[model samples]
Target: MKKIFLALLLGSPLLNFAQNKLSGVVTDSVNKPLKGVSVFLPDIHKSAVTDETGAYVLQNLPSGTVKIAFSFVGYDTDNRSIPINPGENVLDIQLQPSEFKMDEVVVSTVFNKLQSQNVMKVDHANVRQLQHKGAVTLIDGVATMPGVSQISTGTSIGKPVIRGLSGNRVLVYSQGVRLENQQFGDEHGLGLNDSGVESVEVIKGPASLLYGSDALGGVLYFNPEKFAPAQTVMADFGQKVFSNTSGSNTTLGLKTSTENLKFLVRGNYTTHSDYAVPDGDRVTNTRYNEQDFKTGIGFSNANYSGVLRYNFNALNLGIPENGISEQTHSKTPDYPRQRVYNHLLSLNNSVFLGNSKLDLDLGYIANTRSEFEETATPNLKMQLNTVNYDAKFHLPKFGRWESIVGIQGMHQSNTNKAEEFLIPDAATDDFGIFGTANYEWKSDVLQAGLRYDNRRISSEAHGIAGVEGSFKSMARSFDSFNASVGYKKNLGKPVTIRLNVASGFRAPNLAELASNGVHEGTNRYEIGDPDLKTEQNLQTDLNLEYKNDHFEFFVNGFYNFVNHYIYTAPTAAQIDDHDVLRYVQDDAALYGGEAGLHIHPHPLDWLHYETSFEMVNGKRKDGDYLPLIPANNWNNTLRAEFSLKNFTDGYASLNVSHTFGQPHVGAFETESGGYTLVNLGFGGNVKLGKAAFNVSLNGNNILGETYIAHLSRLKTDGIPNIGRNIILGVHFNL
Candidate 1:
């Protein structure tokens, strides 16, 4: 018996040691499994490919300290080195999406998708993704992200909305400075172009804790890369030709980084013509054209960085008809109509102070926009000039906590025709102070913040020019406190969970509550009320993720409850032959969810797929679906890649997206119909003597089908949908 017991004990130890292994699953943004993904120790030749379920298993992985590298086509590579004892280990990784614009071989989505199990999420994107077919504006790119959408007034003008929030409920920043545009106006330009951005970060849900009052919905942060000579200079020029619209873009970039100094400067130009429909028809109510320029300089040292930038953009629209009859469809000669010009100057500085940092920003902006209809009287023009300043401090590691505190001040003045009804002639001054602190212990993170804002709005409505309208001044003051907590763990399995909730508030701006007149561009009569109050909201989010060697999936959900949510309410009255609407707020609630999956079929290295879905629903206290909310959407992608030993690399991918119809309030339309679009892409990168080139061709709407989104103002017209498009582009790194 003693001899048998000794043999059993010896065998048990060996069995336990043999069961230990290192394993993980890999996926892309859409949650699709990747195959032919190379996992290896470069110092050694141990490697493997993902199985059919997008899973990979390394058998007999030697126990010890080593690094593992992950590389796949169209995705960024990741390397993690760790020491493993004799035991089973699992690590799941989600790879960032690649861009088709700047660097074909670039890994990472247009927006930088960060890796965090926390409920608070931030994302970024570049111009290529923002300019997808039928995308006529910058906000369009943001629509592809989770918990985000665009409020469409016209193709060229769309506003970003986050979790059923927009307007004053949201804030925007460029290079860490407030964007001083007249954002209160629906037709106001985003006053930004994709050309000058090195990257864009979108903070979803209420970040009012970090930003101030306007961040109730979220904040958009833009950062431009500084020019320096790590490399002499590189240039990117692209031209896109759609069935109906044609666009041309050119960019020149320079970068230099040495021992003590780094400089980066870049400039861009773009122009586009009116778009057409699949049936050879032009939805000519509004034709678009634009020109933009930007210049930036930055200096950096071991402990500090400073940057200065200037940008200008102009937009002109031509009308094809004097007016459209509600029923008959006809084309008219192109007529000169409206134009907008904008310019901005910005400066920013930051310095490290041991465990804390100090940053400062200053900016100035000038804008002029004009509209013309009849040749009888002079055209109406609106002009604005604004300046902004901000100072902030961020402290690192104070025990288990960190803090960010800041103060901001802004002043704006507007000039316009006394009779310009839609555009308010006003002067505004604003001031705010905000602070946020974060605490972490073990697996839990807690965040808290507060902000106070004082604003004054004055208009020359009754002043005498001989006698102008009169001077009317409006002032608003408000404060908000926000807090959230998050927890994460590995639970001895692949399942992960995260939850967070926050409180936020938004102050009403002058335009949403004071403007009164015609907005011919969108064919709606608008009016505002001086009795409007600030809006307040509570938001929460939950997420769950699972991963293994062959499959990966994630689910996310959000809820928003708001008081005094402002929207335009339709009235029974009609003025100047147009329906009238008034801005008003109501108690409302919203809920939505998003999910993604990646599956790799291990039978072969050539085939793989991914799928994602987003859905949202909202209601007023009375149970009516909210207006301007996008319907549920689903997107899927499939790809096949082929590799030849030491020589050729190639791949083909197909993507399809579907959007369901949605209901709206107080409009000639109530709902938009569902539609699906498909895209086909093919190409790969090639290596040549320390240099490489990435090239691809995409055919969008391969079926040549025509369909219009219900959100399209064009739906009111019987105009057919925009036709299919094809794009061929290349990226080279030398």
Candidate 2:
């Protein structure tokens, strides 16, 4: 975190060229000069390759303590923490030859540390690779990662599920700000698309200390593309087509940057017809249309730097029922559609102090969502607006310790304007203060944090003289304390271990405290408890990893216990032709783990083989299984990488996934059968005149297997997921 802030401070008083300019010499273990070694500073995306003389120079680096990584092919990577002063820094580095792989730099940690340096586990995915797999949506692509899944209504409506948790339990961040789109609803989707996003990072466990409430499950961080490198301008355009849905997607983007100023803008439009099922039947009213626009502007100079960004999105989603319409390839969506528009704005600023720095982020979001069951008129409409901010102070470094003190808060309001009211207009306020510390010594790293929060919720009352009304005047307040500690240490040259313990709490949401009617999506009569207590949880995690050049293996496990767990179950009653269910509290436990390995085998550097498995089990204190739990799953991949003379780097892969049947069933919950899906994909870059183009073709569900997923919201409707589909895509930058 300190490095990120210092990098922005530019030429602040704390920086002096004579002290900050760094020059280094590289050599092999035996003191022989090593040419072409990569010297990189991940925080600012600065890098240089050693010259023939085994020397590298990084000029005008910000004044602060930063981590530098040295990498080269067929050699062990080396890293060091160096204090950047206000004057010239001359240092020499030496590398060792070994059959070891280099670790990636992770920015989601805020400190910009390498994967091997963090105590917590963060799963990362490359959006470009996902696109190569022919995924239709961002969630669809990321679900392929271990310990992650998606709850889908159709091809267009999907929500990210982390360790069997979705909905409000998971928090989504984009444009460097927390996204607030009506997430409490079961059918709500991630309002924003993957526009301008370069990569994604998933935290598989509770992260309430960094984000606030709603992060009790985990955090999904989407990092946008960095500005076109200094003194460069670029434009990119691409198109994609999906076979099953007869869909077409078009996108265009442009970016430019000077030594001190940078700007970017992008726009995308997509249209898809009803998707076909394995039985050749098309799901009616499942077609959708979308439009997304994003832009950013940034400035940096001597004392500080800041970036401001804005995003706008519009979507037309169809509401599916029991009818299956004839397959159609029309771009116009059918009736009974939902029209949603979202607007997001954010600003991030940083300033450098003598030996430390400060980082601040502010954001505002407005989401207007409306649903029309039939006709052109909307039957239900809701608007949500939120404002939030975060500020952190990086303390001066002391020996091997680094610390940060911060405060976070948000204000929100929700209103309804429609013929029917599912919830009352509400207002909410929240505030939290916390501090965290990190230390690195020898081959071990330690991290910990504590936070205290206060929340207040209230809503206007709707009363009827005699007939009926929605909610009564209400107000509720909750306070909680949270903490986490973690440690990571290297066991040997090729082995590493990590242990972590964290406590998290969630205040009851408005729906869990005030709902008093039927939820059409789930076909259930719902009721809320005003006296429900806050949900509290504690989790312990352990991870072990071993890696060497061509082979890698890792095992990650966790046990979580939750008090006052909130859930809804049937009371053996019916109302308005719907089942009756009430939100209840119980003590529960959830435990699971993930293990994986990747191997290239000796003398087969271009050929790779990988296998991974993930499982989770949840039960109440009374020994009842939880609803919507995912089944055990495993995946394997066989890939090959090759090169074409003066053309590009080419690769191809076969991916297979098998899900085991789930027999653990809760009251009134149906069991699901296991299934398997296989996919094939290949892609590569090509030289087209003076430009480089990416071309790929992928087949999803190539075998056309018909089966239902355990977590699909449409499973109860007897609707099978998408069938065999082929996708083709091409893109180029000019």
Candidate 3:
């Protein structure tokens, strides 16, 4: 356990918006000055550490209440609120001894509070711990959480799936900005770097009231790394080795914070050869390389605070077209490779009024994707640019109710540069308004929200409909209203239950409305429909939890009914040298649940056992199974912990994940077989010359099983997933 101490002081109030400074000294219980004590203001993203003289200063802070947290080794964490004014102020703090228990704060929902006090059920994980487990990517680490999974084209590309919904239904928030990366395609993956990310929070059900559109399935929110403590500068370096791919991933980052300003930067690079399958044969054209960078700068004053961030990602991914071949570990990819680049910039700001606060966020994203076939020029090219904005005002609290009213919207344009046109050039605009509130009382919490949205989509003509049977110039408009209500009750000191009902809707994307010609890398030629109704759904969720020092248990269930669900399927005729498919709509329903338990006996406190299972079923109104439905899964883990004198926390775990056979599939989908894989990992932190270093070793599919996943696009080609991979990583902070 670590021990820490903190003290917050309120400075004299000032009416003007000017720079404010706070200087303080930190001392131990013995009255001796302590050096290297970390001090931070969460709301302003500015922080500093005590110098050799036990003195710390915070500059350029907003004039209002701010949350400051102090932490150090061998001390308990201290966090509290302090008022800042427009002039210089002085305060001193003393440290004390206490036991260690982490107090986590959640920010995904509008109500920013500790998870223990939040009414909504959320799943969260520490990125540092996930890194310790040697997860190669952010999605891979998130998949370990209950009810969360990823749909993969291969190791190099994947998208997140929550419960039973994926693709455009799930929303991802990064750096306080909604991520828009042409997510409608199966080959598109989240173009993000995990180097400087701090944590992840997952909402497993409908969240349309908070987020206007594309929240019908769920949400994944990523929190970037915080600024360094005041008076301190830090850097971290890490490297990982991939056995199956004969690859390497390396990252380096640095951060610094002063009185009123903070900055951080990170760079990462990855290169991998073809991935090896169960039979020791390499999957041809499965190699890739990536380069990514992220940086941020923060500034604050008495009246306002803001941070500007930028992220750039470039990848050269090989789109597999050949069969299994003799082993080759070349870095140069095959002919049919894809080159993708993304530039994202965002600004987040907060303004404090007399008794309320206003929050604003702005973001812009530019994506360029191209495919190079046999020729030197790209065979397919597409460029997408989007700008989005969000604003919210927290109303003055009245009694026990906390409320916020907000408006958010996005403007996007899509254009094609190659001769082949998959989807015509299109422009879209969407806007929404929402208000949410929470009522709190002794042992019970009530929450509700309402939202309304309008969307317009316009596409340029590609060809005449009568002769070519293709899409012409078209336009469409859609609007919908959504609402949600939830109640949380505490049964006792160790039991709790929550019930929630929510409604959500989604407007059709441009591809569904104007797509024509054959889809690259697939056998189907898709024809879009100009007339598609908006999709709407209602879901009811129930959650139960029982937790204590020795044991933990949880269960979650949900049922959803949707009207006018859109899907694409094959027709009776062939078009453009391929099987014809048409976009269609129907009513659909889906229901599923997840359950888990964890135990640690009193006498054997160092040993633990855990297990969890998840399953979902989806069907159309005609009673046909839905496509791309994930199979039922069961996971088990056994672990033991031990502490070494003069060393840090250490643990070892053995795990197994079993996926049941998927006999229920769509008309064109094939049944998948069941399979189980074993995984093992262990890691520990060590202190070396005033620096902390972490090391971990993890193994996946140790037995090298050969199997196909139901959601894999390559499954139809009888391509098995990667097998028998060992990963080793080391991270050192200085």
Top candidate on lDDT is 3
The full ranking of all candidates by lDDT, starting with the best, is: 3, 2, 1
Residues 1-734 of candidate 2: C-alpha lDDT, one tens digit per residue? 33453354343532432225788899988888889888865444445678898998776566776568887865767776677877688889988775434455666666667677788888877787778877898888888888888888888888888887778888999877889987888878887677678888898888888887888878899887767655668899988899999998888999987655678999999889888998889888788999999998776543445777889999998877755765676766676778889998887776656578777888889999998887778888999999988888888889889899899998999998887667779998989999989999999999999999888999888756222237877899999899999999998878999998988878888888877788857778787777888888888989999987678999999998889888887787777787878888999888898999999787977888889999999899989997777889999989888889755668898999899998986765689999999999988889856778888889999999998898877778888889999999988886
Clashing pairs in 2: 1-111, 18-87, 18-88, 19-86, 19-87, 19-88, 20-87
Supply the TM-score for candidate 2.
Answer: 0.92
Q: Which 10 successive residues of model 3 have the least lDDT summed?
A: 1-10
Off by over 4 Å in 2: 1-61, 66-81, 87-102, 463-469
lDDT of 3 by residue, 1-734 (tens): 00110010111222334667889888878878889777866666776778888898877666666667666654545665566766887778887643222335677888775566667888878887776666777888887788888888777888898887898889999989898888887778887767778999999888888887788889999999898765568899998999999999999999887655679999999989988888888888888899999999876667667788889999888888776865699866888888899988888887777457788888888999888988769877889998888899988677888899999999999888996666778898989999999998998999999999998989887656643325698888899999999999889978989999999988888778877777666888777788989889999999999877678899999999989988987799986678889899999999998999988777787788989999999999989988878899999989887778646678899989899999999877899999998888888887776777887888888888898888877788899989898998888886
lDDT of candidate 2 vs native?
0.81
Per-residue lDDT of 137-199 in model 1, one digit per residue for the tens?
Answer: 567666666667776533466677776666667787875566766676655557677765755
How close to the true structure is residue 41 of candidate 1, measured as C-alpha lDDT?
A: 41
Q: Cα deviation in Å at residue 180, candidate 3? A: 1.2
The clash count for each model shown is 42, 7, 17
Output the number of the TM-score-best candidate: 2
